[model samples]
Target: MPPMADIIAPQAAAALLAELVRCPSVTPLAGPAGQGPYGEGRYAALLGDRLAALGASVEFREVEPGRPNLIARFDGPAGSPSVMFEAHSDTVAVDGMTVDPFAAEVRDGRLYGRGACDTKAAMAAMLLAVQSVLAADGGLRATVYVVSTCGEEITGLGAKALVGDGFFAGGRVDAAIVGEPTDLDIIHASKGSGRFHIETRGKAAHSSAPADGVNAIYQMAHIVAAIERDVAAALAAMADPVLGSPTVSVGTIRGGSQVNIVPDACTIDVDTRLIPGQTFQTMAALIHGVLDRSRAARGDLQYVIHNRPAYPAFFIDGDAPLPVLVARACREVLGRSTLRAAPWASNAGIFAEAGVPSVLVGPGSIAQAHTCDEFVEIDQVVQAAKLYAAIIRAYGGAGAPATGARGE
Candidate 1:
């Protein structure tokens, strides 16, 4: 490996981030890949080479056929604590972007492009952290795994599969840090999300003879009303003090083949944000209860609800050793102590479900993510690299591990 000062510098990290932005690695369809843009193989290969150059063992852990999570491992001495740093590789589509999505333009100390803020910056920081450790004695007292996951903008398929595959040789990873757009603050908790569809069915008939057929649209209207009136109240009452209230919104509605016919089916897609105490089953029951009440009011209605996968909410004790180390690093770099909860879902939730203590801390603002003109401060990106490097040094650097090593 080259000297850490050469490979892990802020300019080097920024260059890596710029190259990642140029990849246009948008979410691929979740199946067998065609000659299309679904494969993250290109990005994974690029990262693999860099990890290998730094004397790390790199592997492409395939979640799907073409979407592989890049797992780069730098081994430390046996019995030393290990830490995993996670970042996602996929970005949302660039259908309506104001700037060229793949241009990777840098202006006034901000990098503008897709994935610049939502996460590729964090990827660069984690990579530099690993390189910095290797530059100092070729390894740390504790091992480190830098994983770049795929399909985070979609379903978090890579993270789910990575955790299922048994992280860090199926052994304990003392702590994990997920790089998300948290403005460089430590995120102790984030809300989860659930999506599902509800459908109502009825007989189709000529609109001219309105009384001849029951209206599924009318039934759906009653159902929607019930959900808005009752289920919402239930969610509001079940709020968590830290994360605030759980909430639901009906995003889309579709029905009726044509205006002349009475619709046989009406369907609505719903999105719900959950707090720690709320489970998918619990939320499902609440919706079902409301539906039943609507059904009883109109005996001629038939309805079906299908739930998509759910992301459970997660929280870590703020005073835990991992958070303390991360907070100290942030303070050292930024000269301020900042901590908060995120309203969006992150892989941290997935790791927490697996019994690994995880927190989210990274370079940009969540506000700029997925926007038409997305961008991240170049200074933040560089600072994030330094902060990550410091964290690795504080916990896994030189002769003996720190007092907070292994969350002691």
Candidate 2:
């Protein structure tokens, strides 16, 4: 069969990306999802139909009401190893975009729009790769599953739901490749995050009345100092070489009604990055420890804490089957392979935690993910399709690359 890379022309890849960009899938964080400007439902439906056209069995499994995961399965030989190509369907809000977020335009070989670089480019490439493979004269090298997940931006609710959703029946796929913009490099390590809110409460009083009010902002200073001075060092000490130190930073703070009145309440948002073995519980414990120490020092300190769900960090050995296979596939198409580590979390961590060996790779650059005028190089998208198809072809059959067989 002809190389799958040769199947999808640059124009087709660009057009598919244009269709995806034209659809507004910026996740509406609140309320039920709908086929509107802020939901993935519209985009999911479109992609589902495209997958169906390629002779894949398509299904929309809702992880939340109106927010569905579009899963497309292409069956190969009965006993062949199966691989999942997973990409997020949601993009960040396009509040201040320089160009029209839904206007998918090709300008100077760059496809400009929201999510064009972040992921839609990868999504487009993956679809074309699947098409090329299926169109080949010989049957598939391995079974393929193209999954577009929801809620990757705010929280990984979809990925969380995917763990035990029973989509794979009692068994699981042999490997998974998470689609994220990595300039086509392989990402095998990344940090997780636990984002939470911290608030300090106090009595409000008129500024003229001396000693009449306790300052909530002043109370918050102790807590912030504890986190920066006390907890930060401990996080640094436990750093991993690949992903570096897990860390925390106070992102936002709000307090005081005006300059005259004493503050009654103050709220601060904290973002914590975690390494392997850290979870939401651990994040809470670390914060709680600092709060307790602060309270001990200040007898009148009062505070409330809310720990949001965490996105787990992921680490796959460079020599692991999936990473190795993807690396080889990258080399096959790009003439070189680069294994990398990321500080930001992605769906890779979610799938890796579920016993599915996973790695991250795709077209475009991470720097352009949420920029004002987001764009991806047209050539990169085409290259990625070839790389993905190469991975699929090498991963199928008795001598496939990703099965992790020790002796064959």
Candidate 3:
């Protein structure tokens, strides 16, 4: 293979990133043309076309119609382990942005756009890095898969579908790199997330008729307070060294429509971030217990708990081959090694749950993701491409690297 330096050059990475930022691939929201959120189908198609032009086998997998995922494979030597580089194609909706979300404008050294920092930049870097490596002898001991997934902004449905399809069946992947903006930090673990909708029911009655009916809003208030107290305590006590601690937030609440009438129903949407060693089932049971205790105290109220698995927490051991290689690559290409953990959820968890060890490493910062005027440093794009090339060289060989510490 040619030297890694020649494979992922600065100019090539910057050009790829610029091309990606030019695509207006914002997540779709409810509204009119150009006024509403941008669609990702066009961007996926563009990426697929580029991959095909680069001689990689490209497949467009549609999770939902018009919202497609692109998978491109660069075949390597026979009997080599497969490595997947994954990133989301979708960006959060740009509802209240000051700048043109699709301009891909480069000011100073940063590229600004909706998806520039969130993930498209990382996708571009990975693609250019893979293409560069393949351009060289192309006779490596591993196949590289570039996957651009949809619905990462909404429950990671694209990743779930890919995992459910057994895409990694037959022990194909030895390791995976999920390109989430981490400021070039290597994330070995990330918190899992679960969404819960709690509904309380009661009988409506006239406001003046004191004891005529039960007030669901009033009942829900008590329940919400109890949950806040209990959940806060639980999260604070359940702390992990790497992930820090679990977190709970009462994100949304809806109750009475009219002020005079006693409301009969109330709904509370809760978002909980779980650290490693915590499962959705376990968390759900804890929530149920909390509700049960509250209900027991108030026999007049009725409530229901609906639990949804947003994403599971993932942890790769500190000594894991993927993390080690990623750290080494960052040191070689960026003059520093990265070792950190993500506080939020990402698609890396999906790969880990599928038994494919994965790590998160990419350009940009998480702070810039899902925000107005989102941008990524042009230099970070180049550095990420070089790091990708280094990882490919390090892990695309016989005998995979060793596993590291599994963050508790």
User: What is the C-alpha local distance difference test score of each model?
Assistant: 0.81, 0.85, 0.81
Clashes of 2: 1
lDDT tens digits, residue span 1-408, model 2: 445546677888888999999988888865447845778888999999999988889999887777889899999888788999999999987888999888988899999999999789999999988888777745586889999999899668778878868665444588888889999999988888888798999889998983799899998988888888988988888877787788989999999998889999999999999887676688789789888988988799999998886788888888867788888888888999999998789988888777677889999999999899999999999999989888888888446554441110
Q: What's the CA error at residue 165 for candidate 1, in Å? A: 2.8
lDDT string, candidate 3, 179-247, tens digits: 989999898888999989989888888889837878888888987887789877877898888878888
TM-score of each: 0.92, 0.93, 0.93
Q: Which 10-residue span in candidate 3 carries the lowest summed lDDT?
A: 30-39
**Candidate with maximal lDDT:** 2
lDDT for each residue of candidate 1 in 1-408, tens digit (9 for 90 to 100): 667677666578668889888876778754333234456777788888978987888999888777899988888888777888888988876778999888889888888998899888888888877777677666687778888998887767888888888863355676788998888999887788888799999889999987888788988898888888998998988877789999989999998898999998999998888888677778888888888887888787799999886677878778777888888888897887687888888888887777777889998999999999998987788788878887887767443222232110
Clashes of each: 0, 1, 9
Q: Could you give me the TM-score of model 3 versus the true structure?
A: 0.93
